[model samples]
Target: MNRLRAVPKQRLLTSALLLAIASPALAQVAEPVSPSEATELDAVMVTGIRGSLTSSMNLKRDAQGVVDGIVAEDIGKFPDTNLAESLQRISGVSIDRSQGEGSKVTVRDVGPDFNLVLLNGRQMPASSIEATNASNSRAFDFANLASESISGVEVFKTSRAATATGGIGATINIKTARPLESEPLANVGMKAVHDSSVDNLPKPMQGGKWTGEMSGIFSTKTDDGRFGIALSGSYQERDFGYNEAAVGGGWYAFPGGEGPLANADPAVNATNPPGPGDIYSIPQNLIYAINGVSRQRTNGQATLQWAPTDTITATLDYTYAENRIQQRRHELSTWFNQAASQTSWTDGPIAAP
Candidate 1:
């Protein structure tokens, strides 16, 4: 017989003794647990946004330097369209917009040229093309990498022993999924994107439309979990644009008795009757510019891993990516002759026409 015991307190003893007296006696024989019952036991697996956030918190806690990170909800499930867009979520990070899309990042108010980007611990070069020449800019274009097939990204805001020497502002490390660490799996995804602002463009300036993206990943390992292979690929297309009205030619300031507004003396146009010494001016040019941009990106990676012992492992991987862009610009502007009939002006200390 087993006894339920508690400290011998005056009030506690009454409840313990009553409970023990009311309960049934236990069996002395032990029973075996069935295999079916053991197999039916519940198991918990972390996944989705909660899992990603947990992983990110862990990465920050474990990484060196002032590190911040973003982890995927699952394989190939980064929510942003590209790397720069996702990076903007971190504090002290901002992006330079190119054709209405995030192109490069500025960390801690430092320019992108001084920042370094790494792929699986190897520094990657930055390159882009122009009409007349191929300029080798140090700024990495984050728009080139498809957001799919990502495992995580870590940003080091300060230098440490492991930090590469050149990136004074920050060092960015992009991580991809590895097969050996994962269970066998296959996944495919597709997307369609549309930019409503394209419709706001003038008839001749509006050609952008919906685009499509496709991506997939596959991973497998031998029964022993020592040898594994992972393959991933993504193709994405996008149409984007920027439209604005501005004085791109720059403003021209006129003196008291100069320029078209100064020459024209209309009593109704002036805030008050214009004196000969009053200063006024007209716009250099009223211009509206419409810009359209299109981009196509493709990415592919293959990884193979072999681990013969718990202490040592060998891995080989190959990654390839390509980005192509097409752009066009159209402008409509206004200019007036200095003659009083062609233009009317208001006289004041400021320029107006």
Candidate 2:
């Protein structure tokens, strides 16, 4: 009976060891994992005017040279219609509006001739048909480019090896938006403008009419975010005018007691001399001028970007801009001449067509 009891005890000891070995495997398969213990992820999203301001500040801070920049507030919007007008917000920058519109930029007291303008790191063709003196130097016509097609504008105040040579005042670099910069972005805008001067003018001037503008932008990227494309277009028309008055031609001055002509027979002579004084002449011409201007502008841009890997990027961009301007001037003049006596005068008002 004692031998039988020892065998039973040995079997119990073996079973206990087996149970201990299997307990760990069962616990591993039955326990559940909490979702909070998973790996962490990161995301970034920016939009609106605040986003544009932040992006512009970042660009200025990270630039290798002294630079100022302006970023678009949205898909197809800039601060102003004329690029030069927007640039005036920068320090030490000024603009010239000879044609009643901001057409040239002057940086740090330096004229536009010394400043260079670049379109995507390349020199753009010059258009000066409406420029003052028809000057086509290094300056660019800001009116030709529509603000909606641009993504950003950078003004380089200091030179760098990577930058193009030739700007003493500043180098302007205009950049177009890329599709990868945003997620399936699209925008459209239209505006109708009325000019009081043009609308209130008489019948003939009424032809100037009202003005309008239309602009749009579209951007998309591939599912993998490796290839992208952006397209933008804008059309604008404006009618404006200027009114001016001035005095024209020669002047006649005499000492005390001396008349304007010094003679009465319509010719200068000693016997018929009146008096010597500086107050007799009323013989001169007065002029007035009315100028009217009309302009039409169209701008478009297309950009394609390809990134096969995270470390490399390739881009192709194309831009087109056209501006047509029409101008007309009408002048009216009046002449005053000496008649009977040296102190006498005649008046004739003449209109020029």
Candidate 3:
């Protein structure tokens, strides 16, 4: 009979082993993935202006109250040298310039005195060269802070109980960079600025000069990724000039209640009789002034961070800033006095203290 020969045991075993090794089911099983590898795959890195815009949008979307923000384009790089100038880009925000440089910010219809400024999360001291007024009393001088030392700025229009309570306008929070947020980094920048307003004046009146600014940032982390440090500093100097015309002294009303006088009232023939006037109010004093200002700013910041465990972190931060402003004013003033029956003029130089 054509009976099949007995299958060899070794051949049968070898065929079963080959089938197991080549099976699709065996090949479909995946190896376990490590947490670090998975995190890397999901991480997204962004940079430059677009990154700043993206970050700002995210902050707005996630904030609990009405808020706006500006994020730095990169390490030590902000949208503008003046923090007030940068805030002007936000809606409902306005800025006042000092000698053509942004120095103060106003939010909505609220004045500067109604706004509060915080460094990091704590209230910082306020300062200004202006005499105390509705706008300068509680206003922080943005010109004293350096853009290079800031990582972002946030303005909170609506407040919660946890929020700081000084501002009726808005709360401005300045954020600084941290070392553990990135890998080793270094950035240095220099800028030269010229002001045409003062530079184009006559030789004796020209107070404008080429202004220079320098800024730098350095950051690094430990090999174990548990400790980090960051340092930033900036310096700037500027010279500028401004001119003003003003009228002082009370206006004079014509006799017989005819009206105010533009010049000495002829009808009042008293030796002086309200100086010079026609039918409109008379200007008793005329003043012209040219002012020169020189200003310098120095700023610095340092931060250290440590994470001893996955759930524990500690940080230490320090900041310092100094500003100096010197002003000189030249004035030519004319005075008309009916009481003294004399017209006088004076010219002199005034130095600001």
Candidate 4:
């Protein structure tokens, strides 16, 4: 028996400093400090790739179950273009690429549909045309969510008591920025996207221009720390094309290298004859198709938090993403319904034409 795992299987000290002086005659109990009398320590903010990696390492060490994560170094600043690309950095995770971009993810050996995705601990609904079952749409498309507004992503490989249910393979939680956690700031970004695949197509079918991407985020918190708000949105466009030439119905094999469409005779049909136990196969159809595809993805999120007390907080957030696709296809193909005048093949164990 063998086990499968290649990842090299690679702490809280709380000490209360009590400044108390005891006298022999009378004993005075140390009074707890009130909120007004307590000293407020300055908050330490860490940013950059190293800082984010440290944060991820700390989370994994402190978590109760098998877990991994990626944290953003700063607000609206993630290393990858989208969430799906970031997830691929984790061990035991793979993604399905669409048009040179990541779409969905597979955790461990399980498929995408069974993996659960959550936004700030709330269940996120996903739908796809690739779904094998119509009854449920459980696979979330990571490409739909841009990385600008995201703060961090956590992947739990094992089921835990507090997390959401129905993640047979793994549960992924997407954490966004909150008013209190994020400092008061406003940021905007612009990017130019150019895909050479579109330009490589026929001049008539090509989208000859480049696309654009824009994102902005604003976060604010009240001076009293009682109320906070965050708003972020991203818009991205992609112009790409897919050209494929392949066999559609696959090849059908014939025993003894003879079928209704082909004969085993080397003199008339092929250069080599088929042995008694040899086999041959021929393609049913030859297909060549070209498609010009355009895609636009929009993502927006608004979060509001009210922290009436330091220990108790109420958070309300709404996240929305829309993906639109337009495509034009031109295809040229041949179906093997009519026999050709002559087809030839070289010498081999089995004949082919």
| The candidate that achieves the highest TM-score relative to the unseen native structure | 4
lDDT by residue for model 3 (290-345), tens: 88777789999999999999788898999999887787778899986544334332
Per-prediction TM-score to the true structure, in the order listed = 0.71, 0.71, 0.73, 0.74
Error of 3 at 326 (Å): 1.6
Better model by TM-score, 1 or 3? 3
lDDT measured at residue 30 in model 3 versus the true structure, 0 to 100: 65
Across residues 157-234, which tens digit of lDDT does each residue of candidate 4 receive? 999999978999899999999889867989999989878888667877788468999999999999998999999999
Query: Which pairs clash (backbone N, Cα, C closer than 3 Å) in model 4?
Result: none
How does each model score on lDDT?
A: 0.78, 0.78, 0.79, 0.81
- lDDT per residue as tens, model 2, 28-64: 8996878988888887777788999999999999999
Cα TM-score of candidate 3: 0.73
TM-score of 2: 0.71
**For candidate 4, which ten residues in a row score worst on lDDT?**
10-19
Model 1 C-alpha lDDT per residue in residues 43-97, reported as the tens digit of each score: 8998889988999999989976689989988888897877899999999989987
Global CA lDDT computed for model 4? 0.81
For lDDT, candidate 3 versus 4, the one ahead is: 4
lDDT of 4 at 265: 37
lDDT top scorer = 4
